[model samples]
Target: MLSPESAEIVRATLPVVGASLDTITTRFYTSMFTERPDLLDGLFNRGNQANGEQRRALAGSIAGFAKALLDHPEERPDRLLSRIAHKHTAVGVTDDQYVIVHKYLFGAIADVLGEAATPDVIAAWDEVYWLMGGALIALEARIYAQVGADDGRTWRQWRVVERREETPDVVSFLLRPIGDDPVPPARPGQYVSVRVRMPDGVHQLRQYSLSGTGEEGLRRITVKRVRGGEGAPEGEVSTLLYDTVRPGDELTLSAPFGDVVLEDGDAPLVFASAGIGCTPITAMLEHLVATGSRRRVLLLHADTSPADHALRQDMERLADALPAAERIFWYEADAPQGARTGRMDLTGVQIPRNAVAYMCGPLPFMRDVRGRLRAAGVAARDIHYEVFGPDLWLGEDS
Candidate 1:
């Protein structure tokens, strides 16, 4: 809980701080990266930085945390904190990094706000920052302990056993430990960060969803080659994974971490996805099949065409294996027989009253499905979603 004095100050200056967050974040990254270039090697994603998504995400988080503190001072922002902690742990973020972030962030605030950033304002925001950071540090510590990487080390080498192309732009790699050491188990819908050396000799990292169930000693990750457009650079890690890495190659991966996962229950499940977002949903379905679960499952998917659907066959196979599973597929072109054309719509679909829907896709698609599900009597709490990259969902939803 915030000190009453600080809370009052925060509530009073929140509008000014919120309005200047973008500028503060931009200056923060610019100044921090200029002084600490090594952070760009593997810790920070250059692609996200180049396009300003990282700055935007940081701004959203800070503003959201402050707003939440003012709105519900009696409670903590567990959802926001959990999501951030999971992402940080996936990227091997450590406790000390919080200090570095605090330094540059507040410095940027002081610089941007100038005379307006009085000592009271600074102290109040500092309290908010440390509170958020402290919560993340505690959660991350627990995650590391649970994963048995309590030494703050999270990276491990896994050799690629198979590389199979699922689509023209998507590929699936099956990996296994080089030795007989027991592999850590990952829940369905989790992701692992893969770090690779770029042509410039600097390591870059990218997170890919664990696209398959933990099948004995093996794990799977699906990668979609990211194309550059609209002034954004192409994805360095993904491009290298596609063109250079192959079977027999060893890759560095962080322990699987993500807040969204298939809950252990017999509740009716609806798996909705579009494009490459189908990976995690496929993993959940595979888990259900592996466990011989008899739960009612509804599979909903959308894509540009049948050829463009990365895991169409596997998705269909898993759904077929389930006794009470039903499927509805939408495609913009080349709609398969018995499948609908154009975008997905729930107007005529029969969604079970007790269904818990898990959706992963573009922001627009997930937002649309989320709205439709709510309109059809599904509670907001029952509809969970996953974003492939920086989660722009909560900020926009808020």
Candidate 2:
């Protein structure tokens, strides 16, 4: 619990600090990589100055974390801990890393604030950092312990047992860990970090949603290698994983981590995904059928062409299995084939009035989906999203 006076100081400083978020985050990252550049191996992506929504989310999440602490220390954000856990896994952040980040981050804040950061004010922020970081660490530890357990019921790891290109650009890998025979469990909407040692010996990390249906022992992730796509630099790990890595390769992985898995188990679930972002929704479709989620479910996937429509056979199989269930709605932005022949618009279309919505993909796709969902009168809370890069949705420097 924060002291009443301490909390008051936080409240007073909130506006000014929030306004200066960019400065602090920029300084923090600079300080971090400068001191411990080696940690960049597999952790920080090789880039600077966030672009697109990725940049926005990174800045937003950092500022949001602080704002949440200062503003609502008593109520506590339910998804906050889970969000941090997801971030930890996404970036491969560890216990020691958090300490380093917080140390420099707060130090930078002090420098920026100058006289405003009185000793008392500094102490209050300390409590806030520890409290928030403690919550994140505790949740992270619990998630990690799922691995390295004797019981097959818990988490499991797998080696890159095989690799195959299903299409020219679409590649899939078979993971078979030396540990547990049965794969560790993963929620439908969760994702895993695939860590690869770079040519320069810098371990690089990238996240891919598990394509196979919660297959713990033999998990598979199919990635559509974007050749210089989406600001994708000479993808440090993704390239090697695609071009060089062979079967029997070893890579460290975190357990499934995400907050936007299937929810509203009783209500109808609507899945809208675009491009490669279809991975998670595809898993959810299989999960819904496998778990016998009787609630009506609709899958709306947007792909550019017939070849780009991933898991068509598997989705068809799942849909066929659940013949009596809801429905499978695939919206293809087929450029080459010109199938649907138009952009997706739920305004006058297939999205059910009462369905809960989950969407993923590029920024434009998400923005379009959100507009359509909102236009369809979906409640704000009922719609959720998962983003890549950085935590960027909280606030901007308005």
- Which candidate's lDDT is highest? 1
Cα lDDT tens digits for candidate 2, 1-398:
66788778877877887787677777776777788887676567664333333334555665566666566667665465576577675565677777787788888888888898889878877877787788777777766666433211232346787787765667778777676354557777788877666667876667788877434556778776656766555544566667866787776665676777776457766777776777777777777777776776666666666576666666667756764444334444444432354455555466666778888777788887887777787777788777655545443211
How much does candidate 2 score in TM-score?
0.84
For each of the candidates, the C-alpha root-mean-square deviation to the true structure, in angstroms, is 1.2, 4.0
Count backbone overlaps in model 1.
Answer: 0
TM-score of 1: 0.98
- How displaced is residue 318 in candidate 2, in Å? 2.9
Q: Lowest summed lDDT over 10 consecutive residues: which window, candidate 2?
A: 147-156
Show where candidate 2 strays beyond 4 Å: 47-58, 69-73, 89-92, 147-167, 179-182, 214-216, 229-232, 247-250, 324-339, 375-377, 394-398
Q: State every prediction's TM-score relative to the real structure.
A: 0.98, 0.84
Give the lDDT of residue 5 in candidate 2.
Answer: 83
Candidate 1 lDDT tens digits, 186-287: 999999999888889888888899999555679999999998888768787888898887899999998889989999887899889999999999999999
